[model samples]
Target: MNIVYWALVFFGTFFFMEFMAWFTHKYIMHGFLWHLHRDHHNKDHDSWFERNDAFFIFYAIVSIVCFYLWSYEDVWFCLPIGLGILAYGIAYFVVHDIFIHQRFKMFRNANNWYARGIRRAHKIHHKHLGKEDGENFGMLIVPFKYFQK
Candidate 1:
């Protein structure tokens, strides 16, 4: 395929994966998998890379499988899609854990609108503690209603 074709495929797959992530985090992780993800919200001096980090481990395995499929087909198109996943992973690590939570105190201040918005949205997600969970599901963008506080 041409470069433009590859770019389109990569970005389309990337956005789909991101939407999947949001849905997974909201429903799967926050719902049935709460036992595993609870560690993220629980106030404790656990490692900066809390148990919730296991989610990335699963993601890595899926990426490897996707890469293998693409390689077998000689498509080479999925390489950029994998790169997009890596980019989103890095952004999630930096923005969600490191900067927003101040897990490592990496940033003195998160002054950006996106940062503040997501942080506030995540805060709301934690407000109910358990029952009324699954709100503010977006990792990068807030859906306005989440910040109604």
Candidate 2:
């Protein structure tokens, strides 16, 4: 059942990314490295990108390293782990950037309560233009309070 084990690992990585994202957002992004993440909270004109995007590069490097381990070093589990990280990255981009921030001008009319809740929670997080007092750091899994009518 190696295939099944790898599949479970992949899915586990997907869920694990939520915690990683939250921790990185709350601690790393909102912590001393806020300079890199500052523009995400406050806009930098119509630049269409933020220094915050560098966080994606960091994760990309992690995935790339995992791929290198899988291919060159024969660390077999790294393949599924890398794919899982990539998948989570895609989902985070779609949810946080596309759906919540409307960066690409899509998903504006997603009227479902879950969609609404995601938007609401992200809005709360963005309400703090400074790094000090942000909340709702998670993406796909948001607070139940946001889901209430």
- Number of clashes in every candidate structure? 0, 0
Model 1 TM-score is: 0.82
Q: Pick the candidate with the highest TM-score.
A: 2
Q: Write the per-residue lDDT of candidate 1 for residues 1-149, one digit (tens) a residue.
A: 48888788777776776787788787777888877787777746546667777898887877777687678876577677776676677777787888877767787575666666677777777776663444746577668764433
Candidate 2 per-residue lDDT over residues 57-115, each given as its tens digit: 99999999999999999999999999999999999999989998888999988899999
What TM-score would every model get versus the actual structure?
0.82, 0.96
Clashing pairs in 1: none
Residue ranges of candidate 2 with Cα displaced over 4 Å = none
**Model 1 lDDT, residue 139, Cα:** 74
